[model samples]
Target chain A: MLDEIDRQLLQSYQRDFPLVHDPFGEIGRCLGIEEDEVITRYQRLKDDGYISRIGPLLNHTKVGVSTLAAISVPAAMIDSTAGMINSYEEVNHNYLREHHYNFWFVVAAKDNERVDAVIQEIERKSGTDALVLPMVKSFYIDLGFKLWQSTQAD
Target chain B: MVTDQDIIRIMQAGLPLCPEPYASIAASLELDEAELLRRIDAMLRQGTIRRIGLVPNHYRIGYRYNAMTVWALDEDRIDAVGELFGAQASVSHCYKRPSYPPGWPYNLFAMVHGRGLDEINDKIAALKKLIGDDCRQSDVLFSEKILKKTGIRLKNRSSEHA
Candidate 1:
């Protein structure tokens, strides 16, 4: 369960986290709390798995390339197939879905060729044809959640 | 102008979590703090860096039901429909992707999250009604398990390009 301060921190700092020196201190100043207390609370949030990390969300397309790839694997083969795909470090997000194309994953690489290569590799290893869907255009991205609303409701 | 690769190399792993994070990063890259901030500001302005902040774990915060809902719409209607879905607060990622006919027919993809499946289904129904005849068919691909999730890491750029 998150307190009001934690909810406020999550909501306010989703973006534009202080870039200056003593960022925690800066945040403390804003929240009317001590720097040490802020750090402690942040650490607790992270430890409790509420916060993944305090860092930059890199724009992958600006720096590299990425594609959403999905493969239809038989129920019996799902576990082994997912394990094989997950072995590749480039495959960052792998999820089991409800469609015929049961396994889906996103591969982020340095270039288009590498992205294709990963798709091919996964197809060969999984023994299933994979559909590689690269984003033609992004209408919207970076969907950060509103934690405050959930906290308030609770 | 600083090369994007240089900026990526410096900031790929993320800014250090400490006092003077930018100062340390600038020092490592042999750049003045002001110059580093200037480049970052420029990137933000140019849409290179979408955002810089703490990414919350939605699952931990009660948004456990998530789905990547894909819709098959006329190519002409994609932009308009995409814009509509994109504008919604529930839709996180909306994009136009190539649709392979007969097997995979979804061209417009939108990801939505909720506290439960009922909520997700409600959002999907709302989107479906909004799309009406523009959408021929649609499917919700609920995320059953997260195998791996991590920020991008630019592998040895020189080697890759070379």
Candidate 2:
């Protein structure tokens, strides 16, 4: 469903964006399109849920602390527990996965105290002990992939 | 003077979608565009901001399957394994964390993306080929459903941010 330009924009713009007064203009220049078209396409992409946002992916350790906490919630309480955890603004990414620790979510905040507090609160309130696995070291992998690599390879 | 924290607070929400996005951000903070751009550049230099660009949701972009592939590897071999798998094109996020044995025993998390289970299986087989013997056990945890999802929310200085 994606056109060539849409595919290019999605593939190429994952990182190293131009920092300028008119960044969209700069992007337009690179892709041989007008600034307005770039903006409109990006906006449509966001609306269509193809792209989330255009911004900096923060280095969590440098700015704020975060933890990948998982809780083994029984099926009966899955909905209630997810709702409660989602209520917290700090819990941005929550997923229902297939495992004993079925309820997995990320808690990110300005400090470790806030991170711990949220986890503790979840454990106490839900009566489900959480496995708090704070990131020790992040091994770097390049973000984004060649969405059309197979076709392009030929 | 606009501080780095202030910039962080503003940018946590996301870059604006307009012709002159940075200028608009600077105007909101009542700071000049040059100064704001300087701080952003500084953050990029210092490795605080990983990247500044458009991020696509994997599923929407035809990557319908993503596995938070976790491995319980021997402590001595974890570092080697982490570096090896981290370089793979299929793996997006690879990290080393403490493994709680008995219930959870996954210390290395390699978040892999694939078009479907076939592609994922290929990548997994490749990974297994490379990380032989070092890995004690592994499990693939797929996201059955998203209970809640927000792109990224950066907390302000004990205040609020999107």
Candidate 3:
């Protein structure tokens, strides 16, 4: 159960966090709280797993290349196939989904060639044909969750 | 122009959680605090960095039911349908991808998160009503497990392609 302050912090700081010498101090000013309190709350949120991290969400398209890849693996071979795919540093997001092409992962690399190379390597090692689905157009992309609303039904 | 490598190295590790976070990072990179800020500002303007802030773990925050819903729509209506799905508050990511005929026929993908499958299904029903007959078929692929999740890391300059 989160208090109003925790909810406020989670909601307000999801994007456009102050870029200042003392950002927490700035946040403290905004919320009419002390700087130390802001830091403590942030630490608590992270410790409690409510928040993953405080950082920049880099645009891989500008910094590197990436693709969403999927492959169909038998139930008996799911574990081993996932292991093989996860071995690549380029593979950032790996998930098991309820579909024929169950194993899905996102691979990011410095360039397209490298992205394809990593995909090929994964396919070779896993012995599963992988479908590479790069985003043709992104209609929307925002990861922020409304914690205030999320906790309301409870 | 400052290279992407410099920015990636600083950002991949994550922004420091301190009173003077950017200043601390600038000192290590031997960059003036103002210049570092300016570079980051430029990146923001250019869409290199999507956002700089706290990212919550939705699962931990009670959004346990996560599903990647894919829709097969009439090719001509993709942009319109994409806009409709993308505008929903529950939809986090919406994109257009190529559809492999016969086996894979979903072109528009949207990820919806909620407290339970019922909540997500409600959203899907709303989507179905909005899309009408334009949506040929759709399926929800619920995530069973997360094997890995990490920020992208760049290779050394020597190995980087020109």
Candidate 4:
């Protein structure tokens, strides 16, 4: 577990990783640590699954289009169905929601029609019907957690 | 450990191109290359920075379809249902959001994205079969516009305007 110093460092960086040339060096100066140490610790965190990904945050709407799609699958065949859906590279993330349509997942395709084609392919393969509800409006929330505020319990 | 100035410079300029970009950035700040490297490493270790890489552009690659799928689940079996739904690859952002009246029985929410409406429909059909008749209702909320797109800054910047 991270101590106070470690916690402070995490809180600082959780917002956004620097995009500078020598970000490590710059951050190190602030935190008073060696660049290699930061690199090593981050590597360890990622290896341990604490960090999900280290990549760009691209805009979805700007490119072409993207939608949030969902499907309901039988309990027995959920495993098989999910495996089939996951096979597509376009489908990046998936989830199992708690409801009658228990099995819901997302599919990022090249276009609206392409999204439909992939859904059709899933239907043909999984034999499950999906209700395609696209997003008309969306809300944004600052999901960032404040360690200082949250740490009051401790 | 990095100074606030370093972060400001990066956020202002955004991610740079070319190899050994950090070295160039260090030169501009009048900091040693070794020092810059060390600070970045420390910051990442401490969680001051999550990562240093390219964030993907989902729309550019042709993932146009997006929708919010809500499902009606039996209260007693929600745990089991959640496990099942969590296993799917298509569901990126999944959660149990609060429900409202007007016969809004569906309490489970999942995000589904694809190329178009048809692809999402097909998946929904398959999902219906897999989930059995346990779900009494389901609905999809399609996205119609692109509202806002940007990264979240960690610094405590004023947002009185927002």
Measured by lDDT, the strongest candidate is 2
Q: lDDT of each model, Cα atoms only?
A: 0.82, 0.85, 0.83, 0.56
Q: What is the number of residue pairs that collide in model 1? A: 1
Q: Candidate 1, B151: how far from true, in Å?
A: 2.6
Q: After superposition, how far is residue B129 of candidate 3 from its true place, in Å?
A: 1.6
A1-154: candidate 2 lDDT, tens digit per residue: 7787887788888887789989889988988999999999999989999988888877777777888899998899988998999999889889999988898899988888989999999999899789998888878666656566743221
Interface RMSD of each: 2.0, 1.7, 1.4, 12.0
In model 1, state the lDDT of residue A59: 77
Comparison by lDDT, 2 against 4, better one: 2
- Compared with the true structure, what per-residue lDDT tens digits does model 1 show for residues A132-152? 898999899455655544554
- Number of the top DockQ candidate: 2
| Model 3 CAPRI quality | medium
Off by over 4 Å in 3: A141-143, A150-154, B1-4, B155-162
Choose 1 or 2, whichever is better by DockQ. Answer: 2
True contacts kept of 1: 0.75
Report lDDT (Cα) of residue A150, candidate 4.
43
Cα lDDT tens digits for candidate 4, A1-154: 6455444444566445564665666667777888777666655545454443343333344333455455777778877876787776556556565555555555565478977888788878878676554543333222232333343222
